[model samples]
Target: MGNLCAGASPATDETIASADPVERALAIAKRDLAKGAGKWQELYSYDRSKLLGSGAYAQVVKATRKGTQKSYATKIIKKGQYDKSVVIKEIAISNILSEHPNCTKLIEVYEDKANYYLVMELVSGGMMFDRIVKKGHYSEKEAAEAMAVLLSFVSFMHAKGIIDRDLKPDNILLSDDTDSAIIKIIDFGTGEFMKEGQTLSAGIGTAQYMAPEVFKGKYDQRADIWSLGVIMYILLVGFMPFGGKNDAAIEKAVLRGKYALEGEEWDEVSDEAKDMVRSMLQSDPDKRATLQQLQAHPWFAAAASASESAAKGTRMVSRLRGFLASTRLKRLAMLVVASNFKAEEVDQLRELFVTADTNKNNLVDFNELRTALSKLGRAVDETELRRLFDAADMDGSGELDYREFVAALVGQDVVERCTTARHGAFKDMDADGDGYLTPEEVLKMMPPGSTLEEAQEMVKAADKDGDGRLDLNELEILLKN
Candidate 1:
């Protein structure tokens, strides 16, 4: 509050001292975000003339952080555009969902006197439908992969009582321009959380993908499933499920719950796939597939089980060992390195992670890791397996998160190739810039509920020089050795 940036204007003392509840909430939220984001990087500069896009409430501009090349989409929203609750809600929901590998990560948030800044991950990959249309062909495997991510996203959101309200190919995007790029579900501005047995008025969504129940003005999360089914249908074929020359006609067909799988496109598509689509597009929400049924559907299961070979599994185990041998700080460095890679760069490892998670819980436990590594000639010792799992579980969550799994599977060459990455890792831990990492500094990286004692023990293990702190050399050795 002393001055977030130079030449910046803050709310007047009168406004700051307002009795308004919303003003107080906004102030609290901004303070918390600033704390979590840590030290500021000075004022963000953007060219007002060159804008990305502008909506009623905000104008988006492409922003690159001062010291780094990483680009973020920063939305400068008018403070009065919406209530403080809306902005806070968006920030809260986005932060929660960003943990999923497929969601657009929220980078940082800031607010000034007259405007609020929301910085988010920049996804350059074209929209899902456009990518497919340009590629000229979409395979069964591609369709299945897209659906799998979308299905998992829906499952994840529904379990948390959230509804996207808008679920369409246009809202989904690839991480990058690659055949193996993972899907990034986006645009949760219209999202809402439902109370049990509640019927939603249903927020804004495209007509073609909107469920019939949505048109009827009361629907629930099953509407998301319907939208996803429309996407699968479009991928399997080359056209919309309820095609029309205009949106009105499209909505009419959606209400009728009529779509054809009787064209030349359907001949090549499996009957199993068609059946699944029909189940999802039911006019009656009750008759439509529930999340559980959709997940267990034969077509979906058949599509999900379609990865190649056990040799990949054995190879992944070897990588996991190298990852486990590294200290948590080093492991985090490697993860940061991996995250910067292109979609194709880590696609194979991504696949391996998905395959290793047998229950599809989006995390890998020791047994799951065991199954993935079992293709090796020698049976992995239980003790050795436990050790590996413990090492990869960065947050001590008893499981390997997707990023942790990716860090383990990324080649050592990739991890060490970026000197910048190594230095970045060291700098993050050396909070005092003393060229050494202390237990107190390391504790910053540990999960909530982790103790200074645990951090001290971590330091003891990595303090190779025995001076009770980690130097740059020790960190590098731990990263690669």
Candidate 2:
């Protein structure tokens, strides 16, 4: 989310002078009740007094527990509203993620007379977008702290088979307590479930924070990584790294990969911090850093260390083991395995298997398989092809079964090699003790006589969406070309 929501209301309004921006915004939001912004009468049992906030597609209201005064945020979605599929998806995703600590907890859900109402915890703190604007970029330590909390939350969501397609500063909420502010990611209205080999074809999310591949209409959870990078950059810099005057210019600049970070503004920030942002903002999801990899980053090392240290005692260890054994952990492990495969490759393989297995015998002979691979420029000899068949034939049945073949190919290593190479490149790119690659480090990787402008040009070229950072794909592509 951008700062468009910021200062929309006057700061000195007496009604909200003592209240934070969130409270003020909630109050302003209640004004919509007079306009009858949504068809709330049918779905909700209460009247306008409980209304909270109203946005383009949904409205959040204060709903009291059936028998108690305890209040929760109830997000009401009319069935025939803005986008039905997206609304239902958001509801389902919120329900699925209700149990995770980092994610906003959903209290209860009910449908009445054609509308869906999702009850969730209401954090009193203002939006993260407000915090970034007010604070004007955080220090590396502050950024890392916020990121650690966000990463943990995102990791949990991914574990639950949910991809928060829209991850931005506004979607993230800061708790009222400033010292130990918990980052709760809300607004799952654009989220989607990712099954084995699932690839989202629709383009979604705020443009500036979106991944480059999203512009092409084919993306996965790695899209979240792109958004994460954007958020990280904003946390480090007061403005968006990919800002433009209009959507068209921004889109063109992004596709052409135009971006830069020079001058005194970026001097105080460490190279390692920049490098992490660069890697996360990679244009290609294939080359983006994994959540686990992000967690291991030095920027996050402190938090990681603290988390590890916190689990040292016997009671903590027992709890840790139990957590690892929980359904969430098991699902996360499965997601880690599934996330490795590229969406494009899986889609292609799906089509190939469907076409080649015309006999309906559920298996493809060696010749048929070889022919299919050949079309994709992956021709293999009889022995290698047989090995491929055997590897895919988990049942040990010599023949290459369709289901087994698809399953085998869906593994991370099989569908993509970008991640494998990115690890080596990241180490080489980070020449300094700092965890990131500076323009100087990036220049060092180039040929001799490459002017600063040339280096800057290359960086911009590789950025592939003007997001001021480079991912492994852009780096490799720029260097290779």
**Poorest lDDT segment (10 consecutive residues) of candidate 1:** 1-10
lDDT of 2 by residue, 1-481 (tens): 2232231343234644544433443333333222233443433455566566787656887766655666677887655434433443455566667677777886655554455667789887768887766554665567788988888888988876678878999888877737368888888888777875688988778888877788888888888988898898888766787877887677666676555555434644567777898889777678889999998887665433333222122111122222223332122222233334455646755665676676667787767766655554344456745655654444455666644455444323232344543345455566764554446666664446766665565456456767655555554443222
- Which candidate should be chosen as best, given TM-score against the real structure? 1
The candidate that wins on lDDT is: 1
Give the alpha-carbon lDDT of every model.
Answer: 0.72, 0.61
lDDT of 1 by residue, 121-173 (tens): 88777688777565333555677777877888888888766788888877787
TM-score of 2: 0.52
Clashing pairs in 1: none
Clash-forming residue pairs, model 2: 254-465, 257-464, 257-465, 272-435, 272-436
